[model samples]
Target: MDEGANIPQYKLFINPFDLKELKRDIWIDDPIPAQLKVDGKRLEIDISYRGSHIRDFSKKSYQISFYKPNMFKGSKQIHLNAEYKDPSIIRNKLSFDFFSELGVLSPQSQHVLLTLNGKFEGVYLEIESVDQHFLKRRNLPTGSIFYAVDGDANFSLMSDLDKEIKKSLELGYERKFGPATEDFFLQEFIIKINTIPVPEFEKEIPKYVDVDKYLRWIAGIIFTANYDGFVHNYALYRNRETKLFEVIPWDYDATWGRDVNGKVMEANYVPIEGFNTLTARLLNVESFRRKYRNLLEDIMKKQFTLEFMIPRAEKLLQLIRPYVLQDPYKKQNIDQFDQELEVISNYIKERRNYLQRKLAKLN
Candidate 1:
């Protein structure tokens, strides 16, 4: 980790001293092993390994990202690829299977215990490293860590799309709501939400989840019952060599159902209120209503009725039952995760209509 540059420093995470101790004691039989620093000392976990490096501190999953040498730190970096692995925290294989089945493209991971330096400490989600060809074409410095780098595109959010999606028959990742970490405001918000216009083509007015690929994806998410997959979480990476864009889905920690005791519902998925300086302003409440009013109407109309969303959610929960029950320190609280999922799921399913109506009325 050559002391990453462009990497935003964040407030420290809740140190896992207690969890480390628990991991050390039980990791021999566990899938991933881990060791603890005495007294929660200043120790950083390297979240990279192999041809992959991790973007830690993001409001995303506990993951080690796989990438080619193009993104950053090609061949010389102390990434978490070799960090502490406590087999106990690794997601089961079924998680990957279910995600793939849902049309999401994520690296495959198998549970494995980690041995940090000489100590037993954590687990690893040994994933298949993604080819570097899939990222924005750039030769990153040994340690630059900026997100949203577009080395090849015109770099304008408005003009970067290929001719295919530019005609407006298909929508490619329109940023309706900026990340919660962004600073909020009316100008940026308007740009974020109302950027899309109704195409001149009346026959195909930018179908909501109506695009063939995304329609299948919507079906997949409804089937898998994991709504964590969003435009930001998904991307259409253009292969420089192939000159073609392919959509891939990422992040799945919110999969399976919310926990049984109901804590996960309140805790797992957060509303926009928790954001800091940058992301808080990204939600273009007014513009989102205007550009996506009709679509929101459709989702709201069918969001409920347990048949559409519940069965898939339940199926995912059943598949991950073993993993939810295996956390040594119970760091991945099953009940808490469950409650969060249910709350967010129901919100997206039901509240979407009212919210859409609000957006539709915006100036």
Candidate 2:
């Protein structure tokens, strides 16, 4: 087992459970028995496989949706992110912290020492699930919530038509609220953005999407260099009052100088133009492009500096260091942990310079 942190440790016990079934790449509809001990309280929970990729591997992640609401810190559900592919094991939590600190509506994350059925499961990042509870707490209006599961959620014209016609769940979006299982509201929303003329699109877009939040979200992704986030790996919701779609970020393990597969990425890998057709079209408007460029410059100047980031990274590294070294399921060598942090610190410096150069050419 890993050394315990001063923070609350999550002790989960699964009983009458099939270990083989838990390791399979499928979500069993049935709830498996589990006991959760946290913050001096013990609660029973039903756990299940919650991710598309990590489930297929030996090291697993899970969704802990409590049998009762508010069972855990008023959150109905939380994600135990194994972070198997992240050598540093800090990118997801750090990127999220960066966003939240910048006042963006992003998920909150904390590091937890996890033990499953008496065995250490590594240092997992416990992330707040973007559900009804999350929206209520932030005072954000909620209508329908959809998660982008794969590349098909790229906000392209063709993908929009296919979703409307086929209503394929495999099109990479699953509604978490407000809409029925086969709702076309999300599909139609995408079609509206993809088909409308640029001028009309710009005019009507605010009716369906929060342009400021969307720009800031994209700016954060560009600064963080999260390749997976552009087309997928986010949650989109519509506000009933505004009837506008907004987004919250999710699944950030593959960020901050690494690809989704954990390979080292070039410091200048991401361009200032950002990713996805949505950003490209928005940037086509000169005013919008200027605003986006200003956002990048402001983030680099004000928030994402080494003085601000390094200490936070150091503190988290210290907090989870013991657990990471002791966890039996960790994929990276103990030495790589420090190495990865240094790489990220350096990437931050290089990325700032790269963005400065790109912003200079924006005119």
By TM-score, how accurate is candidate 2? 0.91
Instruction: Name the lDDT of candidate 1.
Output: 0.33
Candidate 2: segments with Cα more than 4 A from true spot: 1-3, 24-30, 68-70, 160-170, 181-184
RMSD, every candidate, angstroms:
14.6, 2.8
Whole-model lDDT values for every prediction: 0.33, 0.78
- Backbone clash count, each prediction separately: 54, 1
Query: lDDT for model 2, on a 0 to 1 scale?
Result: 0.78
For model 1, the superposed segments whose C-alpha errors exceed 4 Å read: 1-95, 129-210, 225-228, 239-244, 259-262, 266-363
**TM of each candidate vs. truth:** 0.37, 0.91
Candidate 2 lDDT score at position 138: 85
How well is each residue in 1-363 modelled by candidate 1, as lDDT tens digits? 111122221212323663364335331322222222323333333231121122222111232321222123232112132212211132223344544654544445444333334433223333443334223223411111112212111112333334232322122333222233322222232233334433422222222112333333333343223434433334443333332233444434343333212123322243212221111222233333233344334544554335555565556445434443543333355565455345546644443333434443434
Error of 1 at 114 (Å): 1.0
